[model samples]
Target chain A: MPKSVMHATRAGQPLQPVGRRRFLQVASVATASTALLISGCNKDDDTPSAATVDLGSGDVGVLNYAYALEQLEAAFYAQIIATPYTGISAEEQAYFTSIAKHEAIHRDFFKAAITAAAPGNIIGSLTPDFSSVTFTDRSSVLSTAKTFEDLGVAAYNGAGKLLKNTDYLLLAGKIVSVEARHAAVIRDLINNGDFAADDVVDASTGLDKAMSVDEVLMAAQAFIKEKITATNVGK
Target chain B: MNLFHLISQVEKLDPQAMDQLVSRRNIFTQLAGMSKKAALVAAPLLIGSAFNQVLAGNKDVPAVFNYALLLEYLEEDFYLQALAKPGLIPTGAPMNAIMQIKKHESAHVALLKGALGGAANPRPSSFNFGAAFDNYPTFLAFAQALEDTGVRAYKGKAGEIKEAGNPNDYLTVALQIHSVEARHAAHIRMMRRGAAGGGIMQAGWISNAEANGAPQVVYGPGNPATTFPSEGNTTQAGLNLVTALGTTYTAAEVSEAFDEALDEATVRSIAGPFIVA
Candidate 1:
């Protein structure tokens, strides 16, 4: 088995959400090009970029995957609280503070759990690239928060089947609902009645979006400096 | 919504329906051959799926899917009946949120019914909401409970379906619906904030048994306390999250950080009033 590793950071790529989504659409269509990256395991040597960090296989991979997302969320909320958006109301401020604390606690919980379970296998701290988010503005911050929360919920939901341990599965179940709550509140914050919007939750199925590791990583990779490889995640 | 009620109605229609389901208990036999851990984890899903197949006459549908369908039926009907009222929910965000939620519930009912195939025929639904629609605040309270319960019900079943060790992606689909329920719960909570006195207004996420513990059963434990803890539980996997995470978090924050699941029986009881024969 390959050791869990975090490679050197490669910076300087600012996030363009629209561009990334467009690229993902095109990449998804050109299946051959992205199949190797998304479908299965690609050894470190087989990959082009040595700067990638492997999330490792099975339960550890699942944990690291969650840790990475929590790190992203905690970082986003921390920034939101550090520099409150202009004209932030007292209620909104309270909302952000509570949300920030919850995200931070989640990140730390994942960190502690992984450290105890896998020792040195836990992934290192992630550096989130929030250049795309205009933290000074309420709409910008709330919109970004909504994206992160919804993504987190989908990521956890998608990862459920990957877990081999029932305990880990239950833990993930516990957290995902909270993430959903966060997603809903953030959606409402952005625009009332948008909590379970058709965009994230299917109108036909009435189910929230569920994204695979590859799909989640594709969207999340744009926000983090470190390249994450989950090819063997939950394998 | 209420499994007992639904089963009784089925029994009235066909005296040997339960016998047919029991005789074809493939999922139970599978459970018998598994280790304790696997059996414990998978029984809920396998049994549920088994029922789905037998009851729905759809081999592809899982019991958990039907369980979800039933809940969606209650919620869809709840909102549909409420919205149909003359001057019930006031205009603006409150009405708009209720409308959006109603739409999603109706969609969910359609999705589950589609999955159930021919067995998706409507069961008897004589709702007894009584004066809930006459007042907005009362309607919001019931909505919050139902939504919150819906979230927990889905969570309780998620692990079971995933651990069933099947190639089916039912777990993911269940989770997709689960979070949407949470979103609906939070939306309703926000709408009802400050509607209650004593500063016990509801938050987007649950904070303990909630104000006054009026509907304690909704926020309380299930058949087994160990498997399904209360909403205010600060402990996860036998570890006190508050103490483990240091003093930065209070019991409420710790509780809010994670939502607990409720077993099927508990959920049925909680939702019994709204569902009648």
Candidate 2:
């Protein structure tokens, strides 16, 4: 593998170069006249187009879609740890810190896997604005955590069908379950022992609410200023 | 102009465009002034109706199939590894339960393959079970981890088919598989507590209190101190396990044991390595 790829895998960073040889191949393809011309065309056509990160349609799109969400979560938690919340109990801080580490690991894991499996197709980083959030307040932080976690569960649920890859689906299953746990914990923090209530999960179906890519994008758009689009997502 | 003249002029233009133009003009608004009824009537027509659009375009068979196949590989590999070890499962009832669980996981692999249908990738020659179950402590830990993860995976993906507005056929099959996985988790927790005199384990779970209370005492069957369901009907099926075992254990007690076995940190820790690196 290339040094960059090795470094990325080690550091758990997204957009790792695949390998020296593969990098050359990709570089060659990029520098080739036809490819360059196509790239140029895309750059020039600035007709108020929605900024979208092409996930390459179908199952690939779903994976990239998930990858994008993981990135957001990872970034959020990373920020949380970088600046520890004031007045947080030691136990609570430890718990949240561990969770932040887990999320970061998850984000990087997806990035590495996607890079290895499908190079040149990773979703770009979203510029998140937490202006409305007051991280100092425990309740405010927990409430925000609850919303993100719940949104994650619903988003995963909604995106599952669009996923064509069972491996990705399985991976998603693993991640979402963790997200559910996070949701439950945050819920408990807000209200004693109200973790798995009827509000979050439907009693009859035993399933969380499902939100489509469009729905999630709209919800996430509030925090994210950049226009993130999933190109080549669910075909 | 008179109402008749206005109506005639409106009829001359394209109906759709003309209606929009008139609606925009609010001639009715000018005529009726602050009339709310006109607004209400026009709102429905002016605002387009919402309908579920089925954007069933291209289904990516390779990506979808590969993803499902990977999970099957994980489950299949876990059981294969567990079954390979000799003294992991006790003989008679405990062994039987493990065998059944192994069979169910195998069935899951097969069922998932079937779902993948033709597009399924060829199975990998081998799988790296990683450092999850390096020792007995790790083995139990991994087992708990897998079961918890399996439960979550099912919960997470069950709504996918629903979101696509697809038929419930796929979701039903997936849920059935999910329930089986949960049962396996519950049974494993029972065996871990050395229930049933270390052999011929019953279906009921051993509460943490019971497990920690006495050294040799199995909570169910012969013990009178432990509570079980009476010989009557109840709404919940889980309680029936207690009844079947002839033990007096509350549903909450049984549930707590399951909860204790599947902790969130443990689940995250087990899955974390797999997800990131």
Model 2 lDDT per residue over B90-158, tens place = 566545555555655666667656655555667666655666545544555466446645563454444
Measured against the true chain A, the candidates' chain A TM-scores are 0.80, 0.74
State the lDDT of candidate 1 residue by residue for A1-235, as single tens digits. 0000011011112133333322332234333646554343333334244256889888999999999999999999999889999999988888888888888878988988998899878999877867567788877788778778988998998898889888898889889989988888888777777888888888777788888999888767767766778889998
User: What interface RMSD does each of the candidate structures achieve?
Assistant: 1.2, 14.0
Best by lDDT: 1
Which candidate leads in TM-score? 1
Off by over 4 Å in 2: A1-52, B1-277
- Which run of 10 residues does model 2 chain B get worst, by summed lDDT? B49-58
- What is the Cα-based TM-score of model 2? 0.43
Clashes of each: 2, 26
lDDT of each: 0.76, 0.50
Docking quality band of candidate 1, CAPRI definitions: medium
The CA-based lDDT of model 2 is what? 0.50
Model 1 whole-model lDDT (C-alpha atoms) = 0.76
